[model samples]
Structure formats: C-alpha cells, structure tokens
Target: MKLGACYVAKDNELKPLREDAYFICNKEQTLDVVDGVGGWAAKGGDVGEYARQLMANVIIAVHEEYMLKRSVDLRRVLHETYFHTKVEGSLTSCILTFKASLLHAVNVRDNGDRPDMAMELVVRVEAGDIVVLGIDGLLDNMYPTKMEEILKRETKGQAGSVCLKKVAQQGMRCTTRLTSLHSLHSLKLQKRQD
Candidate 1:
C-alpha cells in the first residue's frame, strides 16, 4: 500500500511555469521533484528548458530502474542527467521512495556526506508524519524554524494541504521570484492498512 498523502503544484504567482517539474510514479512507489537553478538566467540560458529535459530523462531513468526491479537512486539519476543533459545551469532534486516501513529520500546537492553503512536520508516513518521537499528558492525564503511552526499550527485536522499551499504562497509572496520558478511539494506519510 502507498504510505503517504501528497500534493505538488506551482504556486499561482506572476511568473510562467518552466523550471519546476514533479512526477509521481505510483507503480514505482516513488515521487520526484526537480528545481532548476537560474544562475545563467541572465546569460540567455533557459532554466525551463533544461529542467524539462532533465525531468523527462529522470522519468525514463526511473522507469528503467523499475523494470530492472531496483530501487531509485538519486545519485545515479543526477549523473545520468548531467552526462546526457546539456543544461546551462544546475538543478536540485529530491527523490522519495516508499517501501513498507521505510521512506528513503535521495537528495542531490553540491556536497553532502555519502551514505555509509546506514542510509543517508532513510527514515522509519509511520502514519501522520509530514515530509516536505522543495528547492533552495523556497527554503531561502522560509527557514526550517518558521516551517515547523506553520506545520504545527496548520495540521490540526485535514489541513495539511491547506497548510502547504499557504506556506508556498507566502514564501513566493516574500521572494522576488515568481511562483512558476518556485516549486513546493509536500506529503504526509501514512500507511494504507485497508
């Protein structure tokens, strides 16, 4: 059974949608969100185009891995995207895989410690645990401390979706970037026992 309730969207801001891409493969029990960085936005580099191409490649990769009966690997996806994709700028992605009692998160960043004997971002999640993933654009605008408070306040009932939308909208409101350039995805990990 799937172990989460999730929502993904580009906030309704003034910007056009391009650089942010998200896909959920229910057969693979995985979800992926990718955000393109616009360091070359001023240099005629197309963040949106790169993000799209990369996302498509990621979907293919995920499908291939699934066919081979393998787990999702963020690092492999990153490498494949990098070598095959000709993007002017870089992007960050978070891949979440749910299998039974484990929720494995694979985040590709510039630098991070490798998963040693243990998984790098593995969590033994139960029902009612909320997991939010986004790019630096969103986090830069809203810190983790503020996020915790908002999540706590908004999740009193079936308000997880509402809370996430509010957070994404408010984050975009304070930032100079448009909502299209910003992506926010959230899910509450709960098992389906029925």
Candidate 2:
C-alpha cells in the first residue's frame, strides 16, 4: 500500500509544526495517526510535545508488532502506547490504526479519564480505496462529498504519490486560510494577554 502525508504551519508561528502526527509502516501493514488535543498549547509549554510523544510510542509499538508472526491486536498495542504517555501523568490524544483493510480506532478522551479503547470496530475495504487521515486543518477545509470524490478520482487515475500530493496541497490551502484568520486574533491578543 502507498500512503502520503504532510502538514502545514505558518511562518514563525509559536509552534511551527502542528500537533497532528502519523506513522506509515508499509512493511508491517500498519498506518497510525494521532491527534494531540490541547495540552501544552493551552498550558503555554511546548505546544507540539504531546503529539511527538504519542507518535514515538506508536512507532515503537508498530515495530514491535511487526516482528511478531501473530495477527496484530489493536487493544494490546494501545495498552503499550499508554505506558509511554502516562509517564507525563496523562495523555490527551486519539489513535487510529489501519492494517491492510481493517480499521481500529481509540477515541480521544481528555485527561483524567480512563484509557479504555473499548470502542470495538471492524471494517471491510473495497478495492482501490484510499483513506485521508488528518487533523482539523485538512479535514475542516474539505467537505465529505468532495473528499470522497478526490479519493475516487485520483486514486484510480494517478499514482499513490501523485494522489497524496493533490490531497496535501488542498490541505495546505485550508491551513493557510485558517492561519490568516488566526494571525489576526493572535496579533490583537498579544498585548492583552501579557
């Protein structure tokens, strides 16, 4: 399977990189995305840290699972993932894994909640299916019907890299516009907050 991934950040923003992160393991038949909620962003620390920690844990879990011959277990993997996150006391993040055509997700719960990924899910995949995983920056930009159309039309006509480029470009446009709006707010509030 071929996958494409990208993120866009404004020039010299407080956090140049957004909190959304992903991992692609073609060799292990796994794709993971983690959306970090308002952790340091709200607390005035490193705004991008929760995501990096979660992403690292997911990558290590994927590698460990890849070495085993048994079928993958999403629950077990997530349990191990929490081990990495809990060191910071709590984690406010969501995780999703796509293995082959199967989909498993653990929804985001705010800090202080139990780390229970009991939302059982199993899905079937059709031929030539392409999935777009992103944070609000990309998703808030495109409508569902439009996104489906992009996947259907592009995946059939272009290579994996080409399709991903198109999608990322579209996401970049969304974030750029969103950032402009945010910039106005940030500038206005800069003096007030201090």
Candidate 3:
C-alpha cells in the first residue's frame, strides 16, 4: 500500500504540525494516536507532556490487544481504554486492521476540529469524494467544486504524494511572505491561536 500525508500550520501557532500522523504496514495492524491539548494547555510544556504520556499509554494498551487478535477493532479498544482511564482533556484513537481486504479508519475529537484528507487524481479514489474526520482547517479553502478540480488535475499514484507535498511547500512559503494573506486564508481562525 502507498502512504500519503500532509499538514499545515500558521506562524506563531500553538502547535507546529498538529500532533498527528499515520503509517501503513505490511501486516493488517496499524494505529495512529493523537494528543489534542487544546488552547493554552497545549502550548504549556507540562500539559503538552502529560498529553503525550496519555497517548503513549493508549498505544501500549492497544498494541497489547492487537498482538492477541490481528482482527481486533483498534478504534473501539482505544475508545474504551481512554474512557476507562479517564484522562482529562485527552482523546485516544486507533485505526486497526479488521480483515486482509478491508481498511478501517476511526477518529474521536475532544474540542478542536477534525483532521482533513484529500484524495486527488488517484486511480484508487473518485473525484468529488472527500473524507474529513475531526479537522476543519483544510475545508475552508476546499469545497466540493474545488476538490473536484484538484482531483481531476492531479496525476494518479505518485502524483497524490506530489500534490500533497506541494501543499506543504506552498504553506511553507506563506511563512516567508511579509503579508499574512496565504497563511491567514488557508488556516482556520480556530486553528490559529496566535
């Protein structure tokens, strides 16, 4: 399987890269955890650290169960574990393999917007089809029509990664501009705590 990912952040923002990620493996076992320490606490050193530790706990616990049954629904396991742990201001998440052919994605959000993912010009995905979880920053500039244009213009396969990387590069350029036009327009007001 091919892996594709992207993230954008404005200058003086609370979080640099949004504290989230995903990876594809040879086996049908994969999990992604995130620490959404909202507002000031996310910027605070101690609280940010606490959130990371909480995520680690969730991962370890889920990983143990995953080892037992490769078919376990990791997302549900993580949700149950987090609820049982009762860690304040922290949300646990997991994306596990259910079967050899099926791929499942699960997400839980506490206070912030869910993450956004775009599938463009890929033979695997269709046009005008967007899957957005709890993040909202990418949706402001991306609409149904706009997404269709992107999906149509992009090349299939490796082109998806290239397109996503271009987005990252374009966002990086925003940081260098004297005016905050690009950064301000692309990033959501809620995401920009600066």
Q: Best candidate, TM-score-wise?
A: 2
Q: List the residue pairs that clash in candidate 3.
A: 113-134, 113-135, 114-134, 114-135, 115-134, 115-135
Instruction: Give the poorly placed runs of model 3, Cα more than 4 Å off.
Output: 9-26, 29-37, 40-51, 80-87, 90-101, 107-134, 155-158, 165-194
lDDT by candidate, in order shown: 0.59, 0.53, 0.41
For candidate 1, write residues 1-46 as lDDT tens digits: 3323333456657546757777778887777776666564787777
Task: Write model 2 residue lDDT over 104-186, tens digit each, in one string.
Answer: 55543442334453344455656666655555555455445655666666564345435555665676665643322211011
Candidate 1 ranges with C-alpha deviation above 4 Å:
1-15, 111-119, 143-159, 174-194
Regarding lDDT, does 2 or 3 come out ahead?
Answer: 2
Q: What's the residue-level lDDT of 193 in candidate 3?
A: 27
RMSD to native, candidate 2? 8.3
Alpha-carbon shift of residue 54 in model 1 (angstroms): 0.8
For model 3, the local distance difference test gives 0.41
Worst 10 residues of 3 by lDDT: 183-192
Off by over 4 Å in 2: 86-94, 98-101, 156-194
- 131-194, model 3: which lDDT tens digit per residue? 3221223333334344446556774664644564455355454543233222111221112221
Error of 1 at 41 (Å): 1.8
